[model samples]
Target: MRIVEVYQSVQGEGLLTGTACVFVRASGCNLRCWFCDTPYASWRPEGVDLTIDEVVAKVEEWDCQHVVLTGGEPMLFSELIPLTQQLANRERHITIETAGTLYLPVACDLMSISPKLSSSAPALASNPHWHRRHQRERCRMDVIQRLVREYVYQLKFVVDRPADCQEIEEYLAALEDIDRERILLMPQGTHPDELADRTGWLAPYCQIKGYRFCPRKQFEWYGTVRGS
Candidate 1:
C-alpha cells in the first residue's frame, strides 16, 4: 500500500471521536478543498513505502483496539480491502474516513464521509455550484448508494458560517432517506479553541435540527498532536 503516515492519536472526528485509535493516513486525493488540512498527502508524496504486512505490524504497535484508515481520501488505495479485512480478522474495530468522492466497494465497520460543502469555493464564483451539482450527482451519491447497500456511512459536513448551512441542507435533503442519527455537522478549524468557538454555533444547530454534532476530540484534548 502507498501509505503517507501512520501513528497513534485520538480520533479527532466522526462518530467515534475521542477514542484511542491507530491512524493509517494513506496518500492521494481526488479533490482539493479550499480549507484542506493535510495538503502534504493531497498535493505532495511524502509517505514511506510499506507492504501490506508491514502496514499491519505498524497498527499493532499503536496498541489500540480501534483503528482509522484515513487519507488524502483513504479510498484512493485499492489495497484498503485487504488491509481492513486483515485488521478486522484480528478483531480490531476499524473506521474508514473519506470524502465520499468515489464508490467504496469494500465493507468496513464505519464510514465517516465528509462531503465538501459549497462554501469551499475554488476562487471561481461558479465552482461551488458546479461542484455541488455535478460532483454530488457523479460521485458522492454513488458513494451513498453503495455505502447504504453494505455499510454504515455518516454524512459529516464542515461549515464556517450560516450561509454554508444552506448548501449543507441542500445536500442533506437529497439524502432524505438517510437515518438522522447518521448525520453530523462540524466546524472547520485546525485547533481545539477554534472548534470550541464554532461549536456554539454548530452544536445548537444540530440539536435543534435533530442531527448529530461531532467535536474534533483529538484537538479537544491534544490540539492535533502527531503521536499523542
Candidate 2:
C-alpha cells in the first residue's frame, strides 16, 4: 500500500475528535475536492509503498489505542482488508475515514464518511478534467448505505455556505435509517477566521436542524499544519 506520514495525533474530526490516535494516511484519491486539506495525499499523491505488515508496525509504534486508516481513500487499497484485520486483532479501535464513494469489507469501529457536496467540486476553469471526474464519482449512495450499515458511523458534511446545508438535507433525504444526531455539519476553511464566520451561522443551523455541529479543532489547536 502507498503510505504517507504515519503519526500520533489527537483525533481532529468526527466522533473521535479529541481522542489521541495513530493516523495512517494512504496516498491517492478517486476524487479531488477543491478544499482538500491534505493535498499531498490526494491531488499530487506522494508516498513510499509499504507491505501490510510494515504499515501495522508503524501503527504499533504509538501507544495509542485508536488507529485511523484515513486516505486519499483507504478503501482504494484492497490491502486494507488484512491491514484492518491485523489492527483489530491487536485490539486497536479502528476508524476508516473515506469519501463514501467506495466499499471494502474491512473491520472498523467507526466508518467516518464525508460524502462530498456539489460545492466541493474543483474549479472547472482551472482543472476541467478533475472537476468533471470529481462530480461524477463523488457520491455513491450504495457505498454510503453499505458503510453506514456495516459499521458504527458518522456522516460529516463540510458546510461551505448556507446553501450547502440545504444540499445536505436533500442528500440525507435519499437515505434511510440515518441518525440525525450522528450527522455533523462542519465549517469549511483552513483558517480560523474563515471557520469562525461560517460557524456563527452553521452552528445555529445545526442546532435547529438537530445535527451535530463539528468544529475543526485541529486548526485551532495546530493551525493548518500537516500531521495534526
Candidate 3:
C-alpha cells in the first residue's frame, strides 16, 4: 500500500470518535473536494513508503482495539486485506473510511461510506483537471449497496446547505435497498462551530425527517487541533 502517514490517535469522527485507535492514512485520493482539510494526504506528497509488516507492527505497538484504515482513499491501495487480516488475527476491531467511489471486496468490521454529493462541488473552481476527469469516469453509488452486509454500514455526508439534504434523500431514494435508519447527516464545516452553528437547526431537521444527526465529535471536543 502507498501510505501517507500512520499514527496512534483517538478516533476523530463517526461512532468511534474519542476511542483510542491507530490510524493508517493512505496516499492518493481519486477526488478533490474544494474544502478538503487533509489536502496533505490528497494534493501533496506527504507520505513515507513502508512494508505491510512494518505498518502492522506500528498498529500492534499502539495496542488498541480500534484500527482505522483511512486515506487519501485507502481503497486506492488494494493490499488493505493483508493488513486487515493481520488485525483480525490480533483480534483488533478494524474500520474502513472510504468515499464510496470505489468498490471494496475485502472483509472489515465496519464500513463507513461517505458518498460525495455533486454539491460537494469537488473541483468546482481550481482543479483544472478534475471537472473533465469527473465526467469521464463514472462515479458509482453501487459500492454502498455491496459492503459486507453483516454490518448495516453507516452513511455520512458533508453538507453546507439545505439543498444538500434534498440530494441525500434523492440518493437514498435511488438505493431503496439501504435502510433509512442507517443514514446520519452532518453539516459541512472545516471547524466544528460551523457545524455547531447549524446544529440547532439540523437536529430538528433530522428529527422531522426521522434521520439521525452526527456531530463532528473531534471538533466538538478539541476545536481545530488535529489528530486528538
Candidate 4:
C-alpha cells in the first residue's frame, strides 16, 4: 500500500469526531475535489509504498485504540483487505474514510462515506481535465448502496452552499434503505475562519433538516496543518 502519513489525532469529521485515533492516510485519489485539504494525498499524491507489515508496525506505535483508514481514497488499494484484517485482529476500532465511489469488502467498524457533490468539481478555467474526471467519477449510487448495506456506515457530505444541501436530499432519496440520521452535513473549509463562515448557516440548516451536523474539530483544535 502507498502510505502518506501515519499519525495519532482526533477524528476530525463525520460520526466519530473527537475520538482519539491513528490515521493511516493512503496516498491516491480517483476524484479531485477543489477544496481538498490533503492535496498532497489527492490532487498531487506523495508517499512511500509500504508493505502491510510495515504499515501495521507504524500504527501499533500509537497508543490509540481507534484507527482511521483514510485517504486520498483508501478503498483504492487492494492491500486494504489484508491491512484492515490485521488491524481488526489487533482489536483496534476501525473507520474507513472513502469518497464512496469504490467498494471493497473489508472489516470496518465504521464506513465513513463522503460522497462528493457536484460542487467538488474544479471550474473549467481551473483544471478542465480534473473537472471532467471528477464529475464523471464522483457519484456511484450502486457502490454506495452496497457499502451502506454491507457495513456500519455514515453518509457524510461536504456542504459548500445551500444548493449542495438540496443535492444531498435528492441523492438520499435515490438510495435504498438509507437512514437519514446516519447522514452528516459538514461545512466545507480547511481553515477555522472559513469553517466558521460556512458553519454559521450550514449548521442551522442541518438542525432544521434533522441531519447530524459535523464540525472539523481537528482543524479547530490543531489548525489546518498536516498530521493533525
TM-scores, one per candidate: 0.87, 0.98, 0.90, 0.97
What's the CA error at residue 81 for candidate 3, in Å?
A: 1.7
lDDT of 1 by residue, 1-228 (tens): 778788887776778877888889887777766667777776564687788899999999866999888878788788888888899898888888887877646658888888876565444564655455434432476666567557777878888777877787777677646888888888888776677788978899889989888876666677555545
Candidates in order: C-alpha RMSD to true structure? 3.2, 0.7, 2.0, 0.9
User: What TM-score would candidate 1 get against the native?
Assistant: 0.87
Candidate 2: segments with Cα more than 4 A from true spot? none
Q: Write the per-residue lDDT of candidate 4 for residues 162-207, one digit (tens) a residue.
A: 8998899899999999888899999999777888999999989988
In model 4, the number of clashes is 0
Cα misplacement distance, residue 168 of candidate 4 (Å): 0.7
Q: What's the C-alpha lDDT at position 174 in model 4?
A: 95
Candidate models: Cα lDDT each: 0.76, 0.93, 0.75, 0.92
Error of 4 at 154 (Å): 0.8
Better of 3 and 4 by TM-score: 4
Sort by lDDT, top down from the best: 2, 4, 1, 3
Best by lDDT: 2
Off by over 4 Å in 4: none
